[model samples]
Target: MTASTPGGRRVRIALQLQPQHAEYRQIRDTVLRAEDLGVDVIFNWDHFFPLHGDPDGKHFECWTMLGAWAEQTERVEIGALVTCNSYRNPELLADMARTVDHMSGGRLILGIGAGWFQKDYDQFGYEFGTPGRRIARLAADLPRIRARLAAGNPAPTRDIPILVGGGGERKTLRVVAEHADIWHSFSDLETLRRKSAILDEHGAAIGRDTARAVERSVAPHGEPEQAGEALVAAGATLLAIGVSGPDHDLTRLARWIAWRDAQG
Candidate 1:
C-alpha cells in the first residue's frame, strides 16, 4: 500500500512486530498502537521458531497472525518481513495474501523472499537447498503467485503491493527490478548508495524505470533521524524498524514517526 506523501517524495514508516518471545495479546496491542501512532505499515516475521535469542521461545505463524491483524487494526498495512517461499506453495500463498488483503480493506504488503533460515527448513521438514537454488525457486514462483492472485475469486481491492526483501547484488536485486513494487534491503550509507546504483544498473539492463518504478526501503537499527538521513540520501524513502513482540518498543517507533514528520 502506498503512503500519503508531501514535497513530491514518499516517506513511509514500517514497524516489524517480530514474534520472538511474545504473547498474542501483546502482538495485537502493538498493532493497535502502530495504527494509533500513524505508522504506515505493521509487519510480522513468518517463522515457526523464535528468531532472536531463543529457538524455542514464544512465537506464532505468519498468515494466521496477519488474519488477526486484518481484523483487529482499523488502519495501517500488515505483512511479513518476507515470507519464506519454502513454507507453502506459491499459489496458496498468493491466495492467503488475497484473503488478508480483503480482510484488511487492501491494507496488505506482500513482502516475500528466498528462504534462508536453515533452522526453519530443518524443523519444518522443508528442503533447505543451496542459496542459488532458493533464489531460482523464488524467481520461478513469483509469476505463479501473481497469476493466482489475479485468478482468485473475490480479488484484492487493489493490486496488493509486492515487496521483495533482499540485498543480493546479483540475482535478488535483478528480480526486485523485474517483479517487486517495493525493494527492501539493509545497508549503511555507503553500501546503500553503491547498491542503489547497482540496482539502477540492473533496472536499466532490464529496461525498467528504476527511478519511478520501485520504492526503496531499508531496515534502521539506531536513532531514526540519523538512519533516516543516511538512507534517504542513499535514495530510500521507506524506513522500517523492528520491535520484538511481548516487549514491543514504541519508544523507537514514536521517535521514527517524529523523524518522518520532521522530514517535512
Candidate 2:
C-alpha cells in the first residue's frame, strides 16, 4: 500500500545504518534501538569498502546484514539504502530479496540503483563502465529483476516495493517513472519539484500515473527536522537520515521521530 492515508502523506523515517567502523554487534544493537524508537524503515548501504573515515577501516557486506535485520526486527522495513545493480545477477538478487521477504514476513523494500563508486569496482574486479553504460545496464536489468521476482518458486510474500534511487532527468527518471514504486534522491525542494515534473512527463509518455505509482524519498539529514519538514512540503514522503556507527548516535534520529509523530 502507499505510505499515504486519509489524513495525509505519511511521514516515513528511515535510518541508514552505515555499516562501517563498528562491530556487527554495535550495528545490530543500533538496528534494534532504531526499531524500538519506531523508525519506519532501516537501510544499509551496499559497498565493499568504507564510505568515510580511514579507507581501510572495518566494513560489512550489505545483503548479509539485511538478512540479519530481517530476522532481528519485527516491525520496521529493512533494505539496502540502494543496492548496486552491477554487483550481482538480477535473478539471484530477486531470490535473495524473496528469501529476506519471507524471513521478515514481508517487511522488505528492494532499493536498487545503477552502481557507482570506482573503488568498489577496482578492488572487487568489476568493470568501472561509463555512466551511460551503467545506466543502460540498469535499464535493461530492472525488467529481468521484476520478472524473476514474479517467477520465484515461493515468490515474495507481498509485492515487494521497488525503490529506485536516482535523479537523472534523462535515463534514471525515465526508468523510475516506468518501474519504481518509490523514487529516492538527494535533491532539495526546488530541484525535487523540477525533477518531479520531469518524472511526471516521463510517466505520462509511458502511460503511468507517477503520483500514485511512486512515493518520493529524501535524505534530509543536514538539518534533520527542518530539512525533513521542507522536503515533505516539497513532495517527499519518505525522509531517511544517515547515522554512522561505533557509538551509533540517535540524537538527530530522535528529533526526526519526534517531528514525524507530531505530524500525526
For 124-192, candidate 1 gives per-residue lDDT tens digits of 888898999999899999999999999999988899999998889999999999899988886766777
Worst 10 residues of 2 by lDDT: 1-10
Could you estimate the TM-score for every candidate?
A: 0.95, 0.95
What is the C-alpha lDDT profile of model 2 across 1-264, one tens digit per residue? 323333376878889999999999999999999999989999999999888998888999999999999999999999988999999999999999999999999999999999888999999999998988998999999899889999998978999999999888999999999889999986777888899889999999999999767898988846654576567766788888898867899888888887777764
- TM-score result, candidate 1: 0.95
List the global CA lDDT of all models. Answer: 0.86, 0.88
Clashing pairs in 1: none
- List the candidate 1 regions with Cα displacement exceeding 4 Å: 1-7
Which pairs, if any, clash in model 2? none
How many clashing residue pairs, candidate 1? 0
Error of 2 at 10 (Å): 1.3
